[model samples]
Target: MRTAEEIRRVVRTAVEAAVWAPSVHNTQPWSFSITGDEVGIHADVDRRLQFQDPAGREMLISVGAAVFNLTLALATLGYDPLVHLLPDPDRPALLATVRLGGPVTPDEHTKMLHGQIERRRTHRGAFVDVMIPRNFADALSAEAQAEGVRLTPVRSESGKRVLAALTRAAQEVQAYDRAFSLEVLRWARPPGTTRGDGVPADAYPLRPDHTEPDFAQRDYSRDHLWGYDRLPSATRPSAPGLVAVMSTVGDTREEWLRAGEALQRVLLFASAHGVRAAFHTQALELYHLREFIRQEMLEGEYPQMIMRLGVTAEDAGTLRRPLSEVIEEDA
Candidate 1:
């Protein structure tokens, strides 16, 4: 059995690892507090994308991904995490409370995922010539199944093109909406910013490659001043990697959280196998477009995440606020 001190140490390390989970524009919208033997996970409503996610569904999903990472880290350390989802009905902000439990040796898969937590980044550009192995997609689909979510790979060229066009339509419409544009601009930081939250200017390419089907990227860099220099040799159009829709049967806060957990699981698994993902949540965020995707593309399942997974040489750097800023340690 591990001592209390050892448990605390593990909790701290897990939280550190959990920060690396991807968030929309790297918002890092969750906070934590370690109390004796348990860590409390809460949604930082102030960090919520007010205009984009007014209902807090996406924000909670981001928090849930952090929770999943925390659990995975604990498993790697040979302890089971006893989690209570939204335990307090009145305190809607508290997403979960995970306590360190008895030691249980982690499997090879757990350790592999733990190793990938900090190394994964959200890709924002074109993919290499190679096609993703279908076997890997099967492995990823199983990972999603473990969390009550579905991962459907859009491998057909026609399916891929339709999704891309929907993404483009959603991006164009949202860009013109005053409230939505402001929400995204709020998170796009200026270059050389010391702030540890939001998507830094260094997180994407200054010149985005227009992949086939021409899926558009988020205009976080509206003025074309954000992101790093385009890869010098990546001048030609390339494949858009593997397109996928992460969905849950029902669209509830709980289901959204499950979707996020599955999202990170799929991401980490892909990372371990040399793949990175670029999110095109544009369509999912638009009601009509999302409905079209659900009825046409997903066969009526609620689409929670839309992304293209593939290989990229570019390393995108992300950031999160220090634990002290968000954690209510006194609680």
Candidate 2:
């Protein structure tokens, strides 16, 4: 049995790891509270994107990813994380409560995933042309299946083009909408910004680098001279890479949470193999487009995340709020 101080130390370390989980637009829209051997993950509603994520599906998914990281940290530390999702109906903000159970030795795979908690990054631009092993997608699918989610790779050329075209259409519509544009602008950090809870300028290229079929990226640099200077190699048209959609059988708060957990699992597993992901969820934010994709592509499964996975040479930067801003200790 561990002492009280030891448990507290492990809990804190787990929270530290949890904060590194990716969130939409780097909102980091989650907070934590430690009480004894349990950690409570809460959705930080104030950080939710008002226009872009009005329903809070994305917010819950973001917090869910953080929950996965938290539990993974505990597991790596030889503690079984007894996770209870949506433990209280009365408190919707409390997404999960994880109780640390008896210590056990972690398996090699668990340790490998925990090793990538901080190193995994959300790639913003195109991936290199190197071919990802066909078996890798199967591995990632298994990862998602472990969390009760499906990872469907868009294999056909026509399918990829459709998804890309929908992404472009969504990006264009959102760019023209005053409310949506402002919401994106709010999260798109300027160059040399000290703020840590938004998409930093260094995370994307100054000018958009279009992929084949032209999947549109979020206008993080919208009308401003923000973002990193791309290398000459980065300027050329790059491969679209492997496109995949994460989906759930039903679209509910619980399913959203599962999807988020699955997403982090897949991402960490890929990151361990030196692969990265770039998200293009703009189409999912819109109601009609999302429904269309569900009917046409996903076959009734609710899409939770749309991303392109491959290897990238560019080192994209990321930022996170200090623990003091997001954690509460009641130990």
Candidate 3:
């Protein structure tokens, strides 16, 4: 094991990288507490969307993604991360506690993913015509399976259309509800604002290209006209390269965390292959829609994340609170 000071340094670095994990609407709904050589992950419930995510399930899943990022960071640094999910039941807010364990060498692929940890963003536009290599997709599916989750890629055009229509239904439901609209608007930042959290105006295109299935994106703008302008040079709206879902058998809290770990594994692997992912989780937010998808579509598996995968040349950025704001010291 590394010395206390060295462990502290590694933990700090890992938390720094873990902040890049995607959350619903860029809410960044998580915080970290550094206690000696270990770090405790907590859901920043203050950042949760009460109207849209009142149950805290999505918040937990997002924090689980952050935990996955922490493990990846530790692995790349040659320290096996020892993690305990939801360690204190009394303290429901505490998501996980991770610390340095035995030293283990990280492989080339892990290092590659670690490199893109910060640069990867949740894309909000259509993908170019480029095709995602099949081998990479298979490997990502394997990664998800390793975490007890299934990453199913929609193969048929009919399946793609069905998923797209479901997304449309969910988006329409969210759009008409004032409460849901307010929740989204709360996180969509206007241009020129320098907030360190929330979805930036430039995070997605102003006029997103409609793919064949016509997947609907979250209405972050809320019709107030707050977002980046579309570039004039852009011609056609690109295709939806890959439509996929992450699912598991159970709906327990632990399963949610596992789903999140699987999600990060898939996303980082996709990022390594230069593929960006756009999330259409509006369907998953509503209980009936989620239950319907699980029963009719997923064949008894619980849906965690619904996304479209593809390639893009965009240089979108992400933000997180400083360690000072998130990290709580034992003292």
CA-lDDT, candidates in order? 0.86, 0.91, 0.84
Error of 1 at 135 (Å): 1.2
State residue 305's C-alpha deviation in candidate 1, in Å. 0.3
Winner on lDDT between 1 and 3 is 1
Q: Name the weakest run of 10 consecutive residues (lDDT summed) in model 2.
A: 228-237
RMSD of 3: 1.5
lDDT of model 3, residue 274: 86
Total clashes, candidate 2? Answer: 0
TM match of model 2 to true structure: 0.98
Error of 3 at 145 (Å): 1.3
TM-score for candidate 1, residues paired by index: 0.96
What is the alpha-carbon lDDT for the whole of candidate 2? 0.91
How close is every model to the real structure, measured as TM-score? Answer: 0.96, 0.98, 0.95
lDDT of 3 by residue, 115-135 (tens): 877877788878888887777
Q: In model 2, which regions exceed 4 Å deviation?
A: 233-237
Pairs that clash in candidate 3: none
User: lDDT tens digits, residues 1-331, model 2?
Assistant: 6899998999999999999999999999999999999999999999999989999999988998999999999999989999999999999999999999987799999999999999999888888787777799889999999999999988889999999999999999999999999998889888788997899988987777778977889888878888778667544538878899999999999999999999999999999999999999899999999999999998999999999998887778899999999999983
Clashing pairs for predicted structure model 1, backbone only: none
